[model samples]
Target chain A: MTREHLRILLPVLSLAVLLAAVFYLQPRAMSYFGLNLLFNLAIPVALATIAQMMIIMVNDIDLSIGTFVSFCACVTATLVQDAPLLGYAVLLAAVLVYAGIGAVIHLRGLPAIVVTLGTSFVWGGLAILVLPSPGGASPDWLQSLMKSKPPLVPMAIIAATLIGVLTHLLIKRSSIGVVLQGVGGNERALERAGWSIVRLKALAYGLAGLFGVLAGMALVGLTTSADANIALRYTLLSIAGVILGGGEFTGGRVSPIGAVLGALTLTLAASFLSFLRLSPDWQIGAQGAILILVLAIRLLVTRREAN
Target chain B: MSHITTTTPNRAAGLRDLVQKPWIWAYLAAAAAFGATMVISGGQGAGSLFYAALTFAAFSAIVGVGQMFVITLGPGNVDLSIPASMTLAATLALKFMDSNPSLILPGLMVAIGVGMGCGLFNFALILLLRIPPIIATLSSSFLFQSLAIWSNRGIRVKPPEPLAEFTTGGAVFLPNVALVAILIALAAWVVLERAIVGRWILSIGQNLRAAQLSGVPVNLVRFGVYVASAVLAGVTGFLLASFSGGANLNMGTEYMLMSIAVVVIGGSSIAGGNSNVPGIWGAALFMFLIVSMLNSYGLGAGVRLILTGLIIVTVVAFASKKGYAA
Candidate 1:
């Protein structure tokens, strides 16, 4: 296969192998309900992966995403149900803050990682203030919407497909996406071409923030409650997902469909581990191991392609 | 312009130069935090507050020094595994010691050994797997943390009695832990300012390709730095566990951010190449003091966190603006 085709096919193949392994390990997981049980938790993770992909598209990373999502969920559970306008207003302000952060990082040449690291604390703090003890309930509509069953496939799979297709169109096929990717690919070239680098960065961050909000809401929809540190692990999970999906750290290269698939693969890997009766303590370590294995495979592939 | 006025101008210039130093901001912030906390408490507990800040800041300063070196290797080169390394080292060492006083030395060795192993693993992943340091360290930390949890099963193993006393006790009016940290800082300063290895790190951070072409042992230097960072983290974990009377699974959780924050707030360039050892101490103290100030003012965790974030952002902005001007 051509390198281009291989590049696209690798993530798909990995997902297929992982899913097959999971099903093989637990024959019952082949059914619709079983598949839903396995993949349902991946929805928020996929959303988070897409969100991280947006930031990476601009050659930046968002360490605050996990906490930001938790904040959004907290707002959704508490204010969205009680004070709808305030809830949305707070989330909007948070996104604008993200945009402002992008603008500042671009203008000042500050490191996005450190700035986001600092903001993680802010988001965590805000989340706690919003819902101190995690008692807020998801709106009935959201819970029902998340629980709704589809005809053939599970809601999780449908949502994953929808996210992949929509983001592919928005980021891969749109003009704005071109500009955004340009900012990461060759920032100076984009600037020379009369594009405002700062504006492009802000737009990317804003969009990522929007996705983060979606991820949070989706998470709360599934869990039906929220806590300050609920989705804190999503930060690393999203980064790992993005990488597993064939995304590079510095380059503008990203794959929406691949990232979603990557998220699903990770979810399946967890289920696969459980099916193997692996100890819960090692589950996290297995995640790290999987990430290492996938990256190692990519390295070998790149070397082969070079030959 | 007159000859008699030259002395005054020289003095003014000296003050200006000192003010221009990036590390000075951290000290100023530290002092401000101290003063605010003092004011809030009606000038009470000044000595105790300073001592407390010193005690807590020591751990952050130690980890910050290690992180500073890694970050100095340049962009996307942070060691996110510090917390995990600390937890693992502490857990294993404490378990090995089993609270026996004679085993303290052996336990320290075990902690250092664990640190070296973690560092080696991190470096191997980065080199062999071609994984970025941030991602590599992050993933490896999960493994380390898992090891920690698996071995201890959430048990909090107590330190040997004498070891705990040594960690928590004061010597010559200074906390022993603070003294140990100061010694480490001094050693680190000597390395960064006087050693060839430090130069290699700085040059590499400035420009990797250029540094490589200059025949710098880039990989070796990177190997040493990563190992050093893990070793320092391991030592900090050991000390912290002893000082706190035991090791807990989540004991290292706060240090991950604490290390990075101290590095940045200490006025070290986040972009790498440039760094400050004195500033780490100042930033570490300021971090602790600021928390104390916020708590004394009856602010909730949310407000304290928000203020801390805003303060870090503002400091970084000002620091960067100065960097640009210089």
Candidate 2:
């Protein structure tokens, strides 16, 4: 296979392998009801991964995405239900904050990792302030909307597919996408071509914020409640998803479809272990092992291609 | 006219330069934090508070020093495995000691050995596997944490009396742990400032290609730094377990963030090629003081969290911009 084809095939192959392994071990998991159960939690994770992909595309990382999503969930649960106007305003401001973060990082030439890590605490604290405890009911409409059952495919699968296609088109098939990718590939070259790097980065961060909010709202809709720390684990999960999806740290390379598939793979892996009656404590380690194994394979493939 | 222009500008510039030094900001912030603590506590309990803060700062500094070693390796180098290593060390030490006073030394050795093993794993992943340090360390942390959990099995053991004494006991007015921390910092200073190895590390951080061309063993030094960082983290974990009187699962989690924060606040460039061993102590103290002050004022966890985040971002943003090009 050509290198380009191999690059795309890796994530697809990995996902297929995982799915096959899980289905082989537990044949019942292939049923429609079983598939729905398995993929229910994958939606928010996939959305968060897409959000992270946007930031990583700009050669930046957002450590605050998890907490920012949680903050949005808090708003959705409390403010959006009681006072829709204020809730929408706060959520929009959160997106603006992300854009501002991008601007600061670019203008000041600060490291994105540390800046986002710092902002994570700010976002987490704000979430806590908004909802001190873990008991805020999501709006009834949101709950019902997320619960909609389609004919054949599960709602989660449909939503995830839509997200994948929409983002893929926006990022891989559009003119502005070229400029965004250019910002990561060679910032100096892009600047020489008279593009404002700051604006591009800010735009990327804004998109990340928008997706983060969606992920949060989707999570609340599924869970039917919100907590400040609800999506805290999504930070690492999304980073892993992006990497598993064939995204590199320094390059603008990312695939929305691959990310969604990666998210599903990870989610299934966790549930598969649980299905095998493995202890919860070991599940985290098992997940890490899976991530390392996949990355190791990818690394070998890339190294061979280079040679 | 020339003399007047030169003198006026030179004086102003000198003042600006002094104020611009990152260490000065750390100390100023430390002073401000302490003053606030004193004011809130009505100065009656300031002495005890200061001592307590010193003890806490000493622990943080020990961990921070290790983190600084890795950060000095250059941009994109970090050890997320410190917390895991620490937790593992605590568990191993407690289990080895088994509440027996005679086994303390052996337990300490075991802790150090575990740390060395962790360092080796990290080095292997980064060098042999060619994985990025961030993800490599992060994944290793998972392995370590799992190991810790598996071994701990919800068991908690009290440290031996002498080891506990080493952490809590003091001479005249200084706690033993704080003294140990100061000595560690002093040793670090000598190694980084007065040793040949220090120069090699600095050169490597400044420019890897130039350092390699100049006959510096870049890989070896980087390996050594990771090992040293792991060992130091292990030592800190051992002492912290003794100080806290037992070992717990989440004992080392806070160190992960605090260690990085202390390194940055110490005026060390996060991009690497700089060493500020002494500054780490001040920064550690400064961070501890700020947290303590917030706690003393009865601030909520949310507020404290926000302030901590703001402080770290502000310090790193300002400090990294100086004496270096972004």
Candidate 3:
């Protein structure tokens, strides 16, 4: 295969290998019910990964994505369930805050990592103040929406595919997508070309916030409840997914489809380890090992191509 | 003729410049907070509270020093493994020296050794595999956390007596831990401000390609800083576990952000090429005092976190602007 083909095939190939391994280890996982069980938790993670990918596409990172998602979950579970208007208002405000963060980082020439890191605490604090604890029911509409299963395939798989396609087209096929990538690739050049870098970056962060809210809502829908700290681990998980999907830190290169696949692969890996009855501690270590191994393989492949 | 200047004007400008140093703000803020704390407490039991805050601040300062080292390397360089490594150190120290008090010294050595190993691993991942520092360290942190879990087996162990005594025993005016922290800060000041290696590190941070062309051993200096950071983090973990008399799984989670906050609030540039040893200590103390004062006022954890986050963002934003203006 040519380099371009290999670049596209790498994530797909990894996903296939992971699926094959899981199925071989436990044939039951290949069944419809088992597949549902595995992919059920992946939807939220995929959404979160996509959110992270948006920020990274602009050459920025959002350490607050996880906490922001948790805050959104709190809103969905409590305010949205009780007072729909207030909940929607707060959610909209949160997205605006994300845009403000992007604007501040760009206008002040601040590092995105630190800004997001600082905001993570603020979001977590707000979530805690809102919920105080972890006992809030998701809205009936959301619960029912998440529970709907089609005849042939699971709802989660369908949702993931839809999201993947939509984001891929928005980011890779559209003209605006080229501008966004251009901002990351060469900010000075883009500015000279008369594009507003600040506006583009803020738009990127706004999209991240939108996806973060969707991820939180999806999580609440599946779990039927929300907690201030429910999605705390998603920060690292989302970043890892983006990287595993062939995303670069300083480049605007990213694959929405690959990111979703990466998220699914990670979720499957976690479930697969649990199925084997490995201790949670050991499973965590094993997952890190697996991530390292896959990245190492990709590195070698890239190195060979360079040679 | 253009070089002529008035003597009084020059002196006033000099004074202004001195006052304008970013690190000085941390001291001013810390003093203001402490004064506020004292006034609110009505001077009753303020002494002990002050001492307690200092003792805790010492731990944070030590970790902040390590973080400062990494941040000084360059932009996009960070070590996220510190918390996990510290937890692993505490777990290992407790397990190794549980029954025998005399084993405390050896346990400390072992913890430091683990830190060294972690540092080496991080170096390899960044230099050899070309992984970004944040991701590399974060991945290793997960691995270390898992190891910590496996080692402790869901049990908390009390620190050995000797180690405990070292941390807990001290005069009312100055605790042993506080003293040790000051000494470490002094040592760091000497190395970073007065040593040739410090110059090399700074040069690299300022401009990597320029420093490389100028015959700087970029890799060696970078490696040294990472190792130094890990060692300092390990020492902090050992001290913290001993002071608390026990170790838990989540004991080190807060340290990660807190360390970064200390470094930032101390006026160290997050982008690179600048550091403030005394300022880091002052910032750590300031943060600890704020938390304690909030606790005394019965404020909730949510409020405290929000305040801290706001402080970090505002300080970094303001300080960076001043740096650029200067």
What proportion of the true contacts does each candidate reproduce? 0.80, 0.44, 0.58
Question: Per-residue error at A111 for model 1, in Å?
Answer: 1.6
Candidates ranked by DockQ, best first?
A: 1, 3, 2
Instruction: Give the CA lDDT, 0 to 100, for residue B264 in model 1.
Output: 82
Residue-level error in angstroms, candidate 3, position A305 = 0.9
RMSD of each: 3.3, 4.3, 3.9
Local error of candidate 1 at A66, Å?
Answer: 0.9
lDDT of 2 by residue, B1-326 (tens): 00111334558777675566566667777878999988987887877877887799988999899998898888778898899999999899998998899998899898899999989998988898787787788778878888888889998999998888888878766788888899999888888989999899888889989999999999999999999999998988999999999888899977877888788777888778986786788788888898888898899988987887888789778777874552
**How much TM-score does chain B earn in each model?**
0.95, 0.92, 0.93
TM-score of chain A of each: 0.97, 0.96, 0.97
TM-score of each: 0.97, 0.94, 0.95
Model 3 residue A227 distance off true place after TM-score fit, in angstroms: 1.4
Q: List the residue pairs that clash in candidate 2.
A: none
Fnat of candidate 3: 0.58
